[model samples]
Target: MQIISALSEVSDRYPALFVDLWGCVHDGLKPLPGAVEALQAYRAGGGVVILVTNSPRPRAGVAAQIEDIGVPDDAYDNIATSGDSARVAMFDGAVGNKVWHLGPDHDAGFFDPPAILSNPTPIERVPLDQAEGIVCTGPFDPLADPSDLRPQFLAAKTRGLKLLCANPDIVVDRGERREWCAGALAKLYTEMGGESLYFGKPHPPIYDLARRRLAAIKEVSDAGILAIGDGPVTDASGAMGENLDLLFISGGLGAVETGTAPGGDPDPTKLNAYLAQTGVSPTYVIGTLR
Candidate 1:
């Protein structure tokens, strides 16, 4: 993989970019340094920017959250969130009608029906014991360990209920604190014999949704579309699986492992080792989005 200093070096080659939101564009609390400007600059030159996120929040909710965190409206052309993708599956009866919601209040927007579904199945949030399936947005407490849900998962597994995972991110750095995400719970559930369905990064559904969103604006071939993100398993694997070129941001989730300094490029030796260890081969590498 080639290590580049700025996105501008390769931005002109791609007609569109599927950029990951957290870690690439922001740290959950605020926009990452140089990320917003790079996106805006790309857009100014007639490129399409789709904010593809594993956030459990719906597209509208994500838009509001990013704007609140100082990412301007012009930073990208559109958004495709995992929550919306999972919601479509949930309402299509991937999970049964009565589902036990295992997440915090902020993620309630996930229940909002998508405008695209003409005859969406009605979903009812019932208690775990009475539900037919589970819909996991995330843990009720981001700080809590996913193992803490073992008892609850056991009960669900015993009943043979399927779990629909909204976001497939295991954890995210919320400013300075790392917090668990829905993927952790889904991992635990699958480990405990409960079937877990994912609709986010490293999975097909979210990528399909992102492609549709991109096609709505402009028709860019897979060869001309670049995927940018930090997660080796999620971002890198997803891009590779889809046969799209990837620009891995070594300074995000793998900063420490790659020996990347804040707002700086990663040490080339460490970055190579980290990539080798993860078995991910991105087309390019950058310290930050800039």
Candidate 2:
């Protein structure tokens, strides 16, 4: 991967950009340094920016959180989240409405608003065994390990209930810690013989949604779009799935193995091996979004 100091190096090459949220733009609570400005700069240069995220909440909820967390409104043109795609699938009757919510109450925005608004397939959170399906926004406790959800997964599996994983991210960096996400729990459930439906990055539905939005604004062409993100599992895989070019952020999980120099640039040898091990090579790599 070629290390780049500024997105301006290649921002003009793509008319559309699919940007990641959590690790790439912010660390859940605050905007990553210079990340927001990089996005604004890209937009100023005439690129259409769409925020693609694995957030379990709907796009409006995610937008509210980002704004609350100090992300400027002009960073991107539109937003897409796993919850938005999951809601679309649910409304289409691909997944049933009587779902047992597997995450915390803070994620109520994912289901409650739709229920009040009387969406066609408004979701109802029932007890475990009473559920026709499960909507996993995240873990009940972000600080807890995935092992803590084993019993829950086993119980749901034995009942033969399907899971709709709103966030397909295994984990995300919350400043100094790595917190378990819905995808980790869904992986455990699948291993216990339960079926799971994923809605976020590395999945086709979310990408299709973003592509459609991008198409609406300009001539649709995969060759002219670039995917910028931090996770190899989610972002790299998603870009590969859609055959889009990727610009990997090397300061997230990629930084753990590929230690940085004094100036915070990635160690070339380690970064190369990390990408090689994942078998997902990026078109470019940068220490941060800026």
Candidate 3:
């Protein structure tokens, strides 16, 4: 893949850009260097920037985190998260309304009142054994091992409750460490023969919704849209599935496997092989978004 120094080189080719929020724009703790500048520059050049994230929290929740982390308001045109998409699905009656909320209290925003569910069936939160389905945002504790959820998943499997995974990211970088996500738990559930539905990156619904949002801001064909992200399983695969050009940023989650040096230099051959192994070939590769 060709390595680019700045997003400016290809900014003119696409009318819209779908950028990943966590690894691409920032880590969980703070905004990454030059990320905001790159986005501002892209919008200034007339490109519609939509921050597409695997975050299980709704737009409002994600926005709060973004604000707290100091991501400037003008960096992008809009934001969309897996939680927003999952809530839409739940509202459309994709899953039973009576569900168990499985993530931390911080993620309770996904199910709490004042956050209305449009279905005729009343939206209710029940105990795990009494629920018809489950909604998992992520691990209750980011530091906990996914294996710790196996017994609970087995119980759900036996009871035959559908699982709605708000985020399809298996893991994400949180400052200097990696944290397990809802997708990881969903994987465990599936292994135990449980039925699970995921909404987020690498999933078509979120991408389709994102495309429509981008179209609303500025009309652009899928080919005229560029997807920028750092993860292969989520971003690269999702972009390819949506038929959009991809810009893969190095030094994110797979830094070690890609032979990205501590100094921020990546070994091109190793990086390409890692993508190849995942069956993803990005249109371009850059060490950073800048």
Note the Cα lDDT for every prediction shown: 0.94, 0.85, 0.84
Q: Backbone clash tally for model 1?
A: 0
Give the C-alpha lDDT of model 3: 0.84
Q: Give the lowest summed-lDDT range of ten residues in model 3.
A: 112-121
Q: Candidate 2: lDDT of 106?
A: 87
Q: Tell me the lDDT of candidate 1.
A: 0.94
For candidate 1, the per-residue lDDT at 15 reads 98
- 127-216 in candidate 1: lDDT tens per residue? 999999999999999999899999999999999999999999999999889999999999999999989999999999999999999999
In terms of TM-score, the best-performing candidate is 1
Candidate 3 per-residue lDDT, tens place, 197-238, comes to 988999998887787777778888888889999888999999
TM-score (C-alpha, index-matched) for candidate 3: 0.95
Question: Where does candidate 3 stray beyond 4 Å?
Answer: 112-120, 261-265
Give the best candidate by lDDT.
Answer: 1
Better structure of 2 and 3 per TM-score: 3
Positional deviation of residue 120's Cα in model 2 after best superposition, in angstroms: 1.8
Candidate 2 lDDT (Cα, whole model)?
0.85
Superposition error at 150 for model 1 (Å): 0.3
